[model samples]
Target chain A: MEIFGIPAQALYGQLALGLVNGAFYALLSLGLAIIFGLLNLINFAHGAQYMLGAYVAWMLLSYLGIGFWGALVVAPLVVAVLGMALERGLLRYLRDVDQIYGLLLTFGVALILEGLVAQSYGWSGMPYANPLPGSVDLGFMRMPMYRLVAIAISLVVCLAVWIAIERTKLGAYLRAASEDADMVQAFGVNIPRLIMLTYGFGVGLAGLAGVVAAPVYQVSPAMGSNLIIVVFAVVVIGGMGSIAGSVIAGFGLGLIEGLTKVFYPAASTTVIFFIMILILIFRPSGLFGSTR
Target chain B: MTADTAMLSVRDLHAWYGESHVLHGMTLHVGRGEVVTLLGRNGAGKSTTMRAIMGLMKKRSGSITYEERETITLPPHRIARMGIAYCPEHRGIFSRLDVQENLELPPVIGADPLTLDRVQAMFPRLVERRHSPGTKLSGGEQQMLAIARILRTGARFLLLDEPTEGLAPIIVKQLGEIIASLRTIGFTILLVEQNFRFASGFADRHYVVEHGRVVDEIAAGDLAAGSERIRAYLGV
Candidate 1:
């Protein structure tokens, strides 16, 4: 059955793939949003951190015979610890300098990680076995259980972060620190510790996204490279001010990307960028971003 | 140095900004629950003295002891946590946040915090604009909110820079009344004022600063008889 000059099966297939990709998009963009929200750092090394997460999961599974579930639990934690070390050791010293320096420093770190990963793993792709073995039968179509699980887990984690930041007392401190860091420090909240922890949390989210992506996407140094650009587009579409905006924009853009592939496969790759440009023209702050 | 006794004590503090020397061995002290003012003409570095004491800028040298703890090497945020709140000449309210959120920022430290209702009682205008963004407030209202915001932190000592500057007469009177009331509540105040009339009304003692240094100290009662001293130093 064809609809809008495209086959229904192909459209649904793309939609499923889009939703899977959207899971990664949502996770990565959420991480980026946290970094931007709290530290006001662009965190150019986020993609490298994501790649490191995948590598860590792969190594753990290959060497220690770790199960998919075990790698999932451990990878993000490792990345987060490493991120803390980075923040405490390097990023801390650059606080008094112009913020552009932070971006540049992170970019340099990204280059170093990418070069190291490329040298060790080679530019070739590494395969990772699907954690969940079988596909689940849906009323309309057969769905891959692993992909569905990926989307489900991503949603759960994102929701947990949203709740922690939006509903909890800790969230209140984080929001306050982001608004007036000096004032929060005056309240004796230990501003530097908060900054470091938030950085780790943001990096941890990227690692989790990478861990989830390992089965579907080849674990390569370039895995997070191209995906990060799309995630940035998602962030722009969603306002940086709110986490809910980032999540909605991420998933919505993924669906739009899926639909474009079904109707006009040629335009699929360019659609995200096109939307970003349009958004910049129509709403400069973004859909959910505040003008102030 | 006890929390219940001396609020802040600056002893022989010397500070400089890069090559320019400021605060040349100036010493002042504010007791608990006292209102003291640092008054001077333009370019006298009254604001610089405030900034140096608050640790907001790079200093050549100075020892600022708040509650008896030496704060010369402490960061601005750490200094603020020692119960010394500074209201800069340009207010530091988070403009994007609502008035309530702005007020809510100060109590994150687990201090003996003040409630919104208490602050609202002090500045009713803030209560009315509790939901409005801080940037949307009028100049006088913003000043009140700024002062009230610091008070909510339960700060024992406040260093306010030009609170009544550029305000209308009615607002100025209201501010004077608020300051009087705040003092009655046992909050010590260190005010920097360009307006002599405004400072004289609230300050019990005056330290006249000239060229980043305190040249004279006089009690409030003797200000009228000390017109020559004021003209020679303050040019009022």
Candidate 2:
């Protein structure tokens, strides 16, 4: 049967693909929101860190005979340590400066990381054989098992993160620190150490997204650079530092884009940007964002 | 006056906010378990003394030795961990954090911490406002919350900057009684008070600050005799 002049199979297929894409956007933007919120730094190296995640995973599998499961555990840890080093060695020095300097530093880091990887791996791409090769048949469409796993995992992680930041004691410190870090410092909390750990955690989230994307998307340097813009658009529309907003907007926008593709294929690519522009006009802080 | 029993000693403590010098050799001391007051007007460097002692000022110099340990060069967190808690002039109640969260956010650092239950009991008004956002509280409630938050840190010394400002008379009385109780239990407090009469009722001594230094000193016993002199300093 056809739904709105399109076969159910094709329509459901596009929706599933969009959700898988949304999975990555949700993870990446969630990290962006976190780093931006606590550190007060716009981490432009987020895309490079995402690429590093995929590269670390690829190296694990190709060089050490580690599988996807092993890479899943190891990649984020490695990247988190690297992220902590970056914060300690570089970013912390610029903490008291204006936000623009932090943004530019991260931008430089992203360029250097991407450049090094491209020089080594070649700019074209590297293919990663899908680990979960089988597909499950639904009433409307047959969905790949890996894509389903990815969607489910991303949603669960996004929820877990939201809880961690909103419901826990450590979360209270984080929220309070974002509001008045100087007060938190005077209250006996080691703010500099906390900032470093938070930056690592956010970078680790991006790394986790990259590892998850390797088997489905091309395991290449440009892979993250190609997708970061869309993920940023999702962050902007959702609200720059709102965790729930970013998560919801990530998946919500993906599904909306999916619907647009089915209806007007020409506007699918530009639809999120159009919505972002509209949000900027009416609510410059973005939907769900407060003045904070 | 003597460093022998002083829990906090400031010798020629000076600090700067960028190029503008704020604290100019501000010298003071709070004896163990003594309630001392820094009495001054708006631009008299009272708050800057608190900040400098707590290591919050970026350009603080001269000697600040707390518990006989030199803290002039220590970072704010280090000074805080050394058992000195600073409740800022503005109260610093985060709008985003609920009352309970704000109370619980400051980590309990040292021994003999005031349990949350004890704090809640002390400030009975906070019990009902536990779930409300911190800024949702009334002025008196926010001040009580800030004081309560620092108590949980187990700090033996407290730096309270203008806690009675913008507060009701009843709240001020309650805070005065709490300070009396704190002193009885061996807690040293260095308070900055714009309300001279309220502080005179509780302080063991008063340090009269002007510009950025302590220009005069008055013992609690001699307050009545120096009442006119103190009033002149306060410009009241």
Candidate 3:
């Protein structure tokens, strides 16, 4: 069978790859949305955190003789602790300042982190040994087992986070805190602790995404920087801090990008940005964002 | 009165909002089991006084003694934990949460908090709309939910900021009755009200605030004789 002058096999292969990419996008953008929602700050270091997760995983394997499974559990925890420290030591001080300063500060942090990693490991990509080193025939294409696992894991994580924020009592506090921190504090909730934990959780999600991506993409300093721009675009298209919106947009855009690759390989890279522009033109607040 | 006999006492309370001084040496006291109203016009520092007492004002310096403990330098949460509940002018209801969830939000600060059934009995309207979000409720319902939510915290002292604002006459009457009933059950209230007529009927005493300081205090029985002075002070 053939569609758009491309063989079905090629289309399916691209779709599978697109889904894998989408899973990462969902995870990263979900973190971005959470951080933005609670902290009201754009974490430019998200990409760096993602890179740190991958590098941490790689370091665990090479230096500590830990396997991929162990890195999967430990690397994110290490990065999350780093993220919490960064939040407490740095980001909390910038709370009352202008939003632009926060962006610049995080951008500077990203540059420093990336610089430090590049100096030690160099820019060349280092491959992590794939734990799931096989492929499965999924009727249309031979999907890599690791990619499939990544997709499943990412979906579960995204869904779990979404439920925690939207449906639970703790989530109600988070949503309320995002709106009015003073009011939440007045309710006798230790709001500063909540904000710190929320920032850590969001960054932890980014770290987890990095761990997942290390097997598929090379563990390199540029990996996070390379992927973060696309995730940002995904966030914007999905509506800045909308939880479900980010997840849906991430997966949908990934699929669209995949289909575009199969149809016109030249436009695949720029497709998400083009869609973002279009969405901005029509709905200035993004798709799911309230005009506040 | 000393802090020993008073439920809440603010002495020489001074507060600022980032270089702009709002409250300058303001002082007031609420006796145990008393229903007191801080009556003043807009921008007369009535709200600022409440904020200062609640520790919501960042640049506030005052000796706020509650239950004989000086709460001047305590954080808002700490002050809240010390059995003082503040319901701001905006109602401060979390719009994302349902009425039941909103009511359940505040932590219990005292040993004997108002049970859910007791609260529901006080405000039956809340029970009818327990599943509805805070923003979806009517103005009267939101006000009830706000007052009722704090009741669960077991707070003996309530700092209510203009609870009757923007409500219908009947709703205001109902709220006033609820406030009156609350006093009978032993909740010490410090109400900030603009409606002098409504407050005069309900409050045990009225403190006339002007430019961040209390210029006059009138007992409930003397309100009729002090009406002229209060009207001139309030400029209502």
lDDT of 3 by residue, B84-183 (tens): 8989999988777788988887778887988989998998998889999888999888999999999988889899999999999999999889899889
Tens-digit per-residue lDDT, A24-116, candidate 3: 999999999988988999999999999999999999999999988888889889988998999899999999889898899889999999999
TM-score of chain B of 2: 0.97
Clashes in model 2: which pairs?
Answer: none
Off by over 4 Å in 1: A237-245, A280-284, A290-292, B1-6, B11-26, B41-43, B108-117, B124-129, B226-236
Q: What is the alpha-carbon lDDT of model 2 when measured against the actual structure?
A: 0.90
Q: lDDT at B158 for candidate 3?
A: 91
User: Model 2 misses residue B227 by how many Å?
Assistant: 2.2
Report how far residue B142 has shifted in candidate 3, in Å: 1.3
Tell me the DockQ of each model, to 2 decimals: 0.35, 0.88, 0.69
Which numbered prediction scores highest in DockQ against the true structure?
Answer: 2
Per-residue lDDT over B28-66 for candidate 2, one digit per residue giving the tens place of the 0 to 100 score: 888988999999889999999998888889898899998
Could you give candidate 1's per-residue lDDT for residues B70-158 as a string of tens digits? 88898777887777787878776766467876766665332675676788887887888998987789889889888888877777788
User: What is chain B's TM-score across the candidates, in the order shown?
Assistant: 0.91, 0.97, 0.97
Encode model 1's per-residue lDDT on A107-220: one tens digit a residue: 899889888999998988899999887998877778899999999998999899999886666787787677767656655567889999999999999998889989989999
Candidate 3's TM-score on the B chain: 0.97
For candidate 2, the docking band is: high
